[model samples]
Target chain A: MNTGASSTRRRHSGRIVTALLFIAPWALGFLLLVLYPFAASLYWSFCEYDLLSPPRFVGGANYRRLAHELLNGEGFGRAVWNTAYYAVASVVLSVLAGVGLAVMLSWKVRGQAIYRAIFFLPSVVPTVAAAVLWMWLLDPGGGLVNHWLTAVGLPAPNWFKGVQEALWPPDWWSGRAAFGSKDALVLMSVWGVGNFMIIYLAALGDIPKSLYEAAALDGAGNLRRFWHITLPNLSPVIFFNIVMGVIQAVQAFTQVYLVSEGRGAPAESTLMLSLHIFLAAFQNLEMGYASAIAWMLFVVLLAATAALFHSSRYWVHYQGGSP
Target chain B: MIHDKATFRAHLLLLSAAVLFAAPLVWMLVSAVKPAGQLTQDPYSFWPREWRWQNFADAAAAMPFFRYMRNSLLLAGGTVVGSLFSCTLAAYGFARLRWPGRDLVFGLLIATMLLPWHVTMIPRFLLIKELGLYNSLAALIAPTFLGDAFSIFLLRQFFRTIPEELSEAARLDGLTEWGVCWRIVAPLSKPALLTVGLFQFIAAWNDFSGPMLYLSDPKKFPLAYGLEQFVSSYSDQTHLLLAAAVMFTLPILVLFFIAQKSFMKGVSTTGLKA
Candidate 1:
């Protein structure tokens, strides 16, 4: 018995040493790549250093500038409002679209794989390339969209060029503006809902066929069945996607950066907060200010995620039990 | 009768939605084949007046397409092999090995997932510079070659689902721990390996930021980053840009076509796990 116990202990020790060896590279990378940067950003957030200069601590000056000085001035409030609008709207729309697509695809149909392949195709296109493609599509003068509009007895609005007209088109011909403004950002975001579609598709498959049959016998209509059985089953996935989507949306950069020609122009409508941070850090070379912005964004994300989890208990359902 | 009607309605809705979803890509393909002047002149048209098949040839000629293809393949291939090996080793340790502070270490690994890449962008760039691996395919492939927290977590969960008896049987045959891992465990975990490989390949293939940040040499750039170069210079040249974009995405398109069954299965299974 004593020998068995000794052998067990020896085995654990051996495993521990081997585990250490296997994890060493990642641990080293975490230190050099992650931990150091995280701590450095925290420290640098308080300073007022350009990239060229040695950082000097100024104690909340950067934060104060962001809150008080910058907020008081031009386009800052507009940017805050615009980014929040874009992030929140995009997340909600994309989730709806994704779930809707998944539900539609879940039905027994011919060529489901073909549809899946087609839907999934656009996402494989690199974001930079996608942006370039869209820029041509949305071009104001002599673009296909505008050309079609004019050909069909409609006025073509200058998209991505006219700020006020882009956002809220004057109600002359049509009462509703279909596209343009920062809405293009939301539209662009929806185009890449393929990942979310795949997630929802998986979740949809997990819903037992028997549940639907039972619901059918109970005289639950398609809409009712979806609301009663499908919605609750999918709530967990919905919550997860929401949290991830919001986090990703808030940090949205590449699309806006590539699309708006690095200016965030047509009245700074497309400058997301992360793009703001990038402009501050790289373009303006205000490393310290960017650090402050990043920390603030990080805190916002953490708080938002926590709030989502807190609220999820009320709506999100699980099959087994809540954690 | 109502059930049949409902089914018909469902099929119709799905067909319309699928067409709408696929419209953008269809437009992209059409734009690629259209003449440059016509593209700028008619950007959103479904059908082009004049088809310019040579636009692809021209775009290919303008860029070092073959070289970029080779670089992307090597980078993505290297990333797949390295990540599979390193991540599998780490995951095996996490899933199977019993040790002090194992939970704590695993928690730290999960925490690493939330550490945004944007935050470490500059510092990682500095580290790569220090290593003198900048301006080569090494820069594109090396940072990711080590391991990823996400991939490790995914594979660890998979390894955990596997039966322990297989390893014990291999051990009884006088196989070392590593031997059991290789000889028994890997062969049995084809699904998980395919999942990891497909994801890593897609990610490494679509990766633009890594190459954009590290590679100064155009010849060393991957297709994604190479396409970005054309975007900067030829934003107005819609046809050429679309042609280049189409060329950049063709590999992934081909990959998906070839591995469609396995890829969807892998993704869906992993989605459930996540």
Candidate 2:
């Protein structure tokens, strides 16, 4: 009996060792790539460290500078506002557009697969290529969009050139600006809403047809049925899309970098948080300040995510009980 | 039958949306074949007056297109091999083993996905530089050997779906844990593995920021970054630019067509499960 017990213990220890061996690569990466860098970034946020010199502790200075700039509404403040505008506007629009497209694609129509493929194709285009294509498409002069607008006797806003006239014309049009780079960015984002549409399409497939049939039997029209049955069933996926959309919009950089000509030009109107942090660290060589901005962005994202989760209980419908 | 009017309206809306979404890409392709003079003079033309099929050749000549393509393929291939090797092993450990603190460690792995890349960008860059990989494609590819959080998570999920009886049977046949993972679990998870590989390939192909950060040498620039460089210099050559963009995008578009099922399944599964 003692021999049997000892043998089992030995086997258990062997299994543990084998497991460790299997996990070694990821553990090493988690430590070196993730954990160490995470700690270093937080520490660097408080220290002035250029690539050339050793870090010098300067507590609160970076934060203070960011706060000052944020209040002054020139540098960091512009970025914050621009990021907020882009993230909020793009996320809301994409969610709406994605759901609409997904529903349309889900309809029992001829050539459904072909339509879905056409819609999904754009999202697969590389970000750099897409940005380049859009830049040409939205060029102020000698562009197809402007030419079409001119042919149709409509006003063609200088898409990448003008400062986005806030609230559009007839409401709060300043007359000094037209649809600007951010608006163009929103258009690009909506164009690639296919990714989110795919998720919604999957969720829509999971919804039972009986619910829709019952709603129809009650004399409910298409819109009413969608509002009652489809909307509720889709709430969970909608919630997921909203959370992911916000996060992705906040991190949007490559397209923005390309569109704004790498410096958020045309009046800094398209400068986003990620681009701002990148320019701060890489361009200006202010690693410390950039780290601070990154930390703030992290905190804001966390809070926003947490708040969304909290609010989701009331809105997001679950088939089973809520977790 | 339910509502002919509603269905008709839906098809109409979907067709128009599809056209709107597809117009830019179609324009990119159409403009690529347009002569340089025709592009500026008649930018709104749906069809080119003169088919300048040689523009693609011109664009290819304008840049080190072949070199950039080679670098891109190398990076993508390296990343796929690295991610598959490392992530599969790690995922097996997480899914099949019963080690202490496994759940907690797995939680940490998932949480890593939530951590924004910006937080770790600077220090990671410095770390890569310290490792003497800076300015080389190795700087970008080396990290993939470690493992990625998303790929590991994906593989783990697939591994968990595999029946434990298979592993046990292999073990009873005197196979080691590694043997069981390699000979049993890996074979059953081909679809998942393919999903991970496809994702890694697309990511590597489309990677802009990695090259932007780690690589400064023009010789090592992948097509994604190299194409951007071409843009800055050849901004006036719109037809060439469009041709170049089309060239860069064509392979990915074709891959999407071939692997559409895997791509859609991977995306949808990740979303639903997450």
Candidate 3:
């Protein structure tokens, strides 16, 4: 009995050694890359630390400036509105477009593989290349989109160059700048909804066909069956997508930086929070201010995510329990 | 008859959407070979009046195309090696073992995925510079060798699906934990490992800001950043720009075509499970 207990203790210690050895890479990374950076950024948010000099304590000044900009709708304020608008608009549109495409692709067709390949091909193109291609396509003068619009006798807006918005045009809104830079970016994003479509397509396959058959026997039409049967079953997936879409949309940077030439040109119209943070820290050397803005954005994201979870109870139906 | 009509409508909707999505790529290909003068004179022409295939030669010659290609390949290959090495080990630990605080640590890993990169961008850059890695590709590639949260999670999920009986049998045969992880678990998890490598490769390939931040020397620029420079200088020569863009984008498309099954599987599994 005594020997068995000692052997058990020895075995437990062996497992410990093995576990530590295996996990050391991520453990060290967590300490250096994640833990230290997290604490340092939090502390630096309260200090004036440019890269060249030691950090000096500057309590609340950066936050004050962010607040001032938020009210005046300048630096951070304009970015806040732009980020909000883009995140909401892009998520909603991609959901609609992705689901629409997924539903269509799920139908039994002659060339299903061909159609799926074609739809997924565009997304495989790298973002920088995609941005460059879209830039030429959406150019206000002599571009393919504008050329077609003019050919159809519709107004051609200066995309990537114009500051006007289609959703909330200002009082001085002219028909000329009907669609603007953010609108153009949103259109470009929807073009690459292939990832979302693939996910939704997979989920659509998992829905039991028997449910549809029963619904049809109960005198349900196609639209009714889709609304009552398809959507409820798919709500959990849609919710997952909404959460991921928001996070990705918030982190969206490369395309925004590319189209705006890194300065949010044409009246700061494309200045997203991510790009704003980039320019502030790297370009202007305002590390303290950038850190503070990052903290604020982080807090806002956490809050928005919490709100989404809170509201999801009313809508998201998990057939098997919490996903 | 009704089902036939519905199917026809679905085909019509799908065909129309495909045309809309495919038009930009088709335009890029056609634009790449257009006579340089036709762009300014007849920019709206749907097709090139004459295919000046010379534009492809011009695009390749106008920049250090081969040099940039080499840099891109090096960067992408380095990341694939680094991430696969680290993520597989960490995943085996998390999936196949039981230790105190293990579940808590795994939860922390999941939480870290939601923390936006901007929050850590500044200090991380400073950390790299402090390590004397500024203006070096190591600054970009070294951190990936440590581990990535998303890949680790994906791999951990895959490892858990592996049978524990194999690992136990290996242990009975005097295999150490490292041997079990690398020999038994890693080989069995090749598809997931390939998925992780594919993902890291694509990310390193698409990464614009990393090179933009850390790399300043023109000699070190990858194709993604180099092509941007090409655009700035030769913005007027749309033919050359389009040709270069097409060339830059082709490798990724070809890779996707070759790995389409695994690539689609990776995406769907991550999406559905998450």
TM-score of 2: 0.97
Instruction: Give interface RMSD for all predictions.
Output: 2.9, 2.3, 2.2
Better-scoring candidate (DockQ), 1 or 3: 3
For candidate 3, list the clashing residue pairs, or say none. none
- Ten contiguous residues minimizing lDDT sum, candidate 1 chain B: B265-274
lDDT for position A2 in model 3: 100
Candidate 2 lDDT for residue A164:
69
How far in Å is the alpha carbon of B232 misplaced in model 1? 2.5
Clash-forming residue pairs, model 1: A144-B43, A144-B44
Segments in model 3 whose C-alpha atoms lie over 4 Å from true places: A169-177, A320-323, B272-274
Model 2: fraction of native contacts: 0.77
Candidate 3 chain A: worst-modelled 10 consecutive residues by lDDT: A168-177
Higher-scoring candidate on TM-score, 1 or 2: 2
Query: Each candidate's chain B TM-score?
Result: 0.91, 0.97, 0.96
lDDT per model vs. reference = 0.77, 0.90, 0.89
lDDT by residue (tens digit), candidate 3, A213-269: 999899998799889988888888898889888888888899999999889887999
Listed in order, each prediction's TM-score against the native is 0.91, 0.97, 0.97
Q: Supply the DockQ value of model 2.
A: 0.67
* Model 2, span A167-226: residue lDDT tens: 334343544445778989988998988788899999999999999888888999888999
Q: What DockQ does each prediction reach against the true complex?
A: 0.49, 0.67, 0.67
* lDDT (C-alpha) at residue A92 in model 3: 93
